[model samples]
Target chain A: MICNFGAGPCILPQEVFKQASQAVLNFNDTGLSILEISHRAPEFEAVVDETIKLVKELLNVPEGYSVLLLQGGASTQFSMVPMNLLAEGQSAAYLDSGAWASKALKEAKLFGEVKVVASSKESNYTFIPKDYEIPADAAYFHYTSNNTIFGTELFETPKTSVPVVCDMSSDIFSREINVSDFGIIYAGAQKNMGPAGVTLVIIKDELLGKSGRKLPSMLDYKIHADNKSLYNTPPVFSIYVSMLNLQWLKSKGGVAAIEQENIAKAAALYEEIDRNPLFKSPCAVEDRSRMNICFVMENKELEKPFLKLAEERGMVGIKGHRSVGGFRASIYNALPITAIHSLIDVMQEFAETVK
Target chain B: MICNFGAGPCILPQEVFKQASQAVLNFNDTGLSILEISHRAPEFEAVVDETIKLVKELLNVPEGYSVLLLQGGASTQFSMVPMNLLAEGQSAAYLDSGAWASKALKEAKLFGEVKVVASSKESNYTFIPKDYEIPADAAYFHYTSNNTIFGTELFETPKTSVPVVCDMSSDIFSREINVSDFGIIYAGAQKNMGPAGVTLVIIKDELLGKSGRKLPSMLDYKIHADNKSLYNTPPVFSIYVSMLNLQWLKSKGGVAAIEQENIAKAAALYEEIDRNPLFKSPCAVEDRSRMNICFVMENKELEKPFLKLAEERGMVGIKGHRSVGGFRASIYNALPITAIHSLIDVMQEFAETVK
Candidate 1:
């Protein structure tokens, strides 16, 4: 079987896919396809409720925070964050470390003043900016926990007096964190969770209803929280798959256990990149993402041949982002450690042939 | 197998569900689940493009119109319609026929002045208002083509000097329409199309970029259309299922053929509701929807026993909306004629027993 390493919409556990496939045809022996069932049905209600419970339990989300399954992905959340939190004259501090971070800052500027605290754009976003001063007067401090395009990740949560909001689209659930530190943490479920439809939003209940501007029902977090994410017809199938994925994660000993495996997987590939004379790592070692391990060949001409060889060897989606053209092996949670070793073996075989 | 009739996330073709279930495991023999594939990948791009093409071809959408598969369902479109079309101080006329229309109006009021020219709330929204005057100076005239909660439908497109915008969430694709007559037609793809999560928006290209107010990236229709709904990571699974459903629709001779079957199915149930002395239909005969058929028994006590009888016989989701307080059998495109016949048989048997 080919190994998939595409960034978002990356990979999921095989067992989860089996259960999800079965659910699509016959959900819980109700003799109805999950695709055809009503969102208001008790079966779907149980799915939503159980998903929220598992997410909270896995992340250790405190009592004051509410877990929500929303649509429109993290891209929509960029605008929603400022729309629901920043008032007319207010400003929100943002860290522009990568492509997604810059995009979020751009969207936030449309709603209100966006105070960019720091940026690594001059270095083509190969590293994360550190020791940035977050404005206490701002509505909130916004940051992306992982930079998918540039293969950089913020290992620690930013310390700020103002409420901290995060777009943890890639790295969420791959590692354990203190959920109480942030006002809101939103992640698109494409990576490490389930599929490319639902978004997981964990918000501190007190942080809601603070934006004075009138908001649409769908855009307002309070309405969703109040109704318990049932204010409208949710993405039922996506949520069901997410619940299944979370169940699988729990069965494999939750986030803490997964984090250890992720570290080992990353270390193996990074070691090969450092040792192999034909390849080099572009991202700063300190901020290198465990999820997306990016590398480049010493001779640029080898890139095309390397990709073809990898493809022929049953490797897929190893092509890097267009802006940073080389290779990105996105080893998400479901990507077995053996897959990483297989990629390394390919890299070694290719290097020997070139030598 | 139980037949689903409650409203959207409603019934889909059995063939579509089978293909969808297989896709959840391996999409097109690519050794990857459709959920795990990238939106930018050829596999998913093909899915999105083919779905749009099928929609345009099936509906006979004119050249100047653009079709988009969007997230947040029709609820977000309630705000997006005004935010994209109505400028500050501008008024848009609305037909307040049912619960969803009122919710749309409530959201529109937040954007600008809403002139509700007609409403059927006085009669419990059991019939569509006729011959209502459309305000000539309004930005656009908005209405719901079918009310799922109240089981009423507009038989013809409302003629207006202002641009016509419709929420065809419940009854879209169940029948053919003059697509050129409306400036925009939006539907949540739960009823006749596919599943919950994605919304189908067919907008006249010229109607966009006129609101003058800054819009969030996700809420801006122009951006989505220009990007071909690839502006962000879309609800990939929902769109894929929608594509499969549309393919199924095409295989069964498109919307015109399905419309004929829909009429027959609705007639069979409605004929039983009218012929039986113990039963009655709440909606006006002329305005009654072919998609969602509502009925009530003379003795309210019979409602419980009839529903139990229907459920025991492998029928599901026939319970009426809580607001309407009776029974609703929503027969969307995928609901078979046999299911409707079974419902009719149940109705006749119940009438004989009670009489």
Candidate 2:
């Protein structure tokens, strides 16, 4: 009955958990735990195949793109993006929207020059900076499509002629995007995907091998793409559970259907936060994230009592990121509308008690 | 009842699987699936702490060494090892005993100069190379402790003045080792540990950052060790299950007790492989891997029929690596001695029928 809603590595569908547990006992009745099975086994290859196909189908990825399920999370992708795309002496443009965004740009700086085209760091990243331009000479334009820490999301792909790379760790599957618009899209699997071990990378095939640097085999996207993400052992259980989760998503009618539900849950919760005298959202209205609904208490002294009552009512993992002291109702794809309603009830009860 | 002899992601204690399955349902009665809990959560952090402690306890890791559970497997370490230790204009010496050993050298070449002190490649890597002299002037001496594919293993650390780095992916934890003898010891978790997603790295703290290379954060061992593998979202499920597996190992009397069991199982299996006239080991006797017991048919024509019968008798993954092309009974730690007996029975039955 606990409405668990922590950030990345957050809630997955109950069915996925059940199926994953069953697989641990016996994967596809192979008489072996999914964990104990070899990655090269035909059964596992099929799982990888289906998982990749599901990602491509859900994202409507174009022919020229390769979708990879890799390890090391989005943090690894931070350096890998520039290692493959930004050639020596070339600079990459970045939109630093939050902590993760700043971290991404910082890693990019190690490989080559980085230009901060826009950043809301001065305002403590409460809003996504909009009034900035992607330098025409920059090698690529990078942005955080959704800043989980700041509760902000960039809805529109910036108007840039150059290729774009995005960190969509929090919002990849909650809504559909034009896959062809970006040269590279990487997200850690902990959020909308499945778990923390694997990451999803969608790369425009042509964008690889352009970097003048001699990259290590693991960091080379072309090597992974050419090998179909089987360049190494891969995070097998993570990918298998992700495959199950994606299948669940497909059964619930894929990304488009999930988007409608996500929007509804966010709209309801945001409305409640705005309506309740005790609560207020910390994000800009136009840029607020649909997945991670970050909010704060209007009265500072009420925060602890509100959290305690919510906990007593079985609301878990509502604590926000330390960077921003508040509550974050992460209504990711797996969170049902019922959890949102329960949260609203808690908020209303708290408001009445305070009055 | 099924005997899975796959080389890696091979086998683990049954209780670990059951517990892992239950955790997927609800981790520690937190009313949250382990897959859904945030990595930053106190419960997950405790899991990480205990896992690191378990590694140090099981391996008897000495002072000045760091034990880290990382993602990307040993293949990632193939590069990270060189990237962290091989300084510019310096050369690293490698002992090329098998395919994996050769691949490690190739990756080292990407970082700086790699000196292959000796290679058994001409013999199809059927034996561990022994007569090589590691250059004192080299950055460090590198070697693969166990060659999973070719069924060769280096049991004794080579006498080298330079820091010795070993990729013990296949044989770590199967036997006791002096941790102070090497600069680094790394192993992928799939074999003797838990599953495929996480890797174990034990580093002698002083050897890192000597490469003088500004490594990408993920590739740098110091960053991971300093952060205790929490620099980013770790492969949480893999690490968690590894902790459970390590606990199971400890309950079974830790590595010393398991070593005896492993030796007994390996001795019995090797005895059967040697006794059955139809089959003979392809690897050198002195260098034969106790973990992956590779043997080929004495009469090549009997190979297919023997494998078919073995499969019918529930002997799975006994097929040798394609390079060796006969059979490999990978008797990893969690594989009971009973499975070894079952394999011997299959071999005897096949031999009697052919006679």
Candidate 3:
């Protein structure tokens, strides 16, 4: 009956964890731990091959797109995307929605000119900025798909003639999206995937080799795509567990089915926040994150009892980010609908006591 | 009973795998899976803090040295080391030993001037080149500690007047050495540490901030060191298992005790190859890699059977690199002494059958 609501390095399905643990002992009856196998071996190659294939299938990537299971997290991609795409005198359009988007734009500025098309910083990231212009001649339009700390998201991406790059670290695989709309989509494998060692990058093959910059082989997607994700020592265990999580997604009828459940879970929690007079959600209603639901109590005195009551009832990791006070409930793909019900019940009890 | 001899991501102790599996299920009795916990939570932070402390103790790193668990493998460090240390006009000395060392050199060359102090490529990397002059004013002397494919190692590092930066990907913690001799040492976690998602970087604090170049945040060691390896989402599962492996090392009398056993194992396998007329060791005796022993069959026709027989006898993953074109027995830190004996026995049987 224990519920976990920690964000990124967040909750994974019990079954995925179980299978991953077993693989460390005996992988595919090869009698060797998955960690011990070389990437060049057929068995290990199969994992890489199948992982890419599954990722492509899940994302509905187009024919010219290549999926890479790379080392480093989304922070790495913030620099690599610019290193591979941007050139001198070419500007990239960046939407600063939160901390992550700000960091991405800062790194991009070091390489080339960056235009802040829009920003939510003025509102302390409590609302997503809607009005922005993307230049047609810009290298690309970059945006953060989901803001973990601010608990905000863009329900619909901006319409831009240029290529779009999104960092979907907090809410990848939780909803359905047309992969063809974006030129590149990258996510760190902590939330909704498995753990925090691998970053999944889906890039359009045609977009590469245009920057003319001498990029490091490790950061270049073209080199990795040419080598089939075997150019370097990959994050093996993280990629393996990610495959298991993807398999679990497929078994539950893919993102389409999971998206419906995610909608219901988020609705249940948001409903409680709206009904309780003592609690208020921070993010603008139109831009609220479905994955991470954040709220603060009107009376700060009641916050302590709310957290302690939830913990005593066996719910864990319900605390919010340090910069953003109050509580956060992270409902990733692996979090079940029943867990949301438990949190709703706890909230209702606290509401009566506060009054 | 299966013996894994793949270079790395290499074998780990069975006990470590088991205990780590338990952590994934219920970490510290928090009723939450380790994969589900937030990084800022006290429970998860404790794991990160303790793991860093354990690494410092095991290596006997000086007070000024900072240890960081980073994402990306050794290949990532190739660019990162120079990006943070080599200023625009500064020069660095590189030793060209094999494919990996050459790749490191190529990455650094893009950053600043580089001097090829020595090269073993002329001999097909069968011997380590000696009598090379290092630049007195160079920013650092860079070298790969062990060549996994070529089976050649620098038994003793050069006494450089400049600071030393080493890529110890294949043979870290396999033997004992003074930790303070080098300014910086990095190893991919797949070989001697844990799995393939994390890299351990140990650097002297004073040597940082020398490079005036604006390094990308993710590739900057000071960024992770300043945050205690929490700058972004780190490779959690890979590092947690690495902690268990390090704990296992400490319980078994640390690196010194393991080095003795590794030495004995390598001696036994090499003795068998040298005494048997049917086999020939590839590298010179003085520069042979204790971690990866490469040997060739005297009769070219026997190569197929030797590999097939070894596989059938449950001695798995002993195939050599395609570039080397011989059998390589990788006796890493976790590879048992019994596994090396089994390989020796296989070699004896093959020799008798050929006669």
Model 2 residue runs over 4 Å out of place are: none
* TM match of model 2 to true structure: 0.99
lDDT string for model 1 (B140-179, tens) is: 9999999998888997998888899999999888899999
- Score chain A of each prediction against the true chain A by TM-score and list the results: 0.99, 0.99, 0.98
DockQ, all models: 0.89, 0.87, 0.79
Where is model 1 more than 4 Å wrong at Cα?
A: none
Query: Model 2, clash count?
Result: 0
Cα displacement (Å) at residue A73, model 1: 0.4
lDDT of 1 by residue, A1-355 (tens): 5888889898999999999999888999988889988888898899999999999999999899989999999999998899899989999999999998998999999988999999999999999999889988999999999999899999899898999999999999999999999999999999988898899999999988888888999999999999999999999999999999999999999999999999999999999999999888899999999999889888989999999999998888999888888999999999999889889999999998988
Model 3 residue pairs with clashes: none
Model 1 DockQ (Cα-based): 0.89
DockQ winner among the candidates? Answer: 1
For candidate 1 chain B, the 10 contiguous residues with the lowest summed lDDT are: B1-10
Weakest ten-residue segment in model 1 chain A by summed lDDT = A1-10
- Which of candidates 1 and 2 reaches a greater DockQ? 1
